[model samples]
Target: MNTATIDTSPIRILRRPEVEKRIGLGRSTIYLHMQQGTFPKPIRLGSGGAAAVGWLEHEIDAWLHEQVSKSRVSSTRA
Candidate 1:
């Protein structure tokens, strides 16, 4: 019998467009946040490619949680 193993990594890389769609932000907005160091840094997918890609899904999820918490806190204060 033969068996195969599957690899599972916490990081889920996404293309620029897909990431923008997922975050509901436009291309410029995405770049703006990146410039502010508030967004995940993209990883180079190739040595000489013009396209940019990135991962750290866990980080994004954490960011979402933080936003939710902030919203709740503000509502409670108001």
Candidate 2:
């Protein structure tokens, strides 16, 4: 293990509340989109076989930006 060569950037994990607030989607809607393969999926946390899960902040941010861009493009076309 080369400690000096390791990149130490932290990844922000957004829990349900934060994710919902950021994406404007409720728990059920988020889960539904996930199942439909239309949204980013959450990552499992910890190692105790727990059911805890969260979405990466950056991923959610990208999704929101993409959605806005698509909306603008379609509205312009119409």
Candidate 2's C-alpha runs over 4 A off are 1-8
Tens-place lDDT digits, model 1, residues 1-78:
657876675557777777767678888887888899887777887766675567566666676687689899999999
**For model 1, what is the alpha-carbon lDDT of residue 48?**
66
Give the clashing residue pairs of candidate 1, or none: none
Error of 1 at 56 (Å): 2.8
Name the lDDT value of residue 37 in candidate 2: 92
Candidate 1 C-alpha error for residue 48, in Å: 2.6
Best by TM-score: 2
Writing each residue's lDDT as its tens digit, candidate 2 over 26-68 gives: 9999989989998999998866777798888889999999999
What local lDDT score does residue 24 receive in model 1, on the 0 to 100 scale?
Answer: 80
Instruction: Determine which window of 10 residues in candidate 1 has minimal summed lDDT.
Output: 51-60
lDDT of each: 0.74, 0.90
Where does model 1 exceed 4 Å of error? 1-10, 49-51
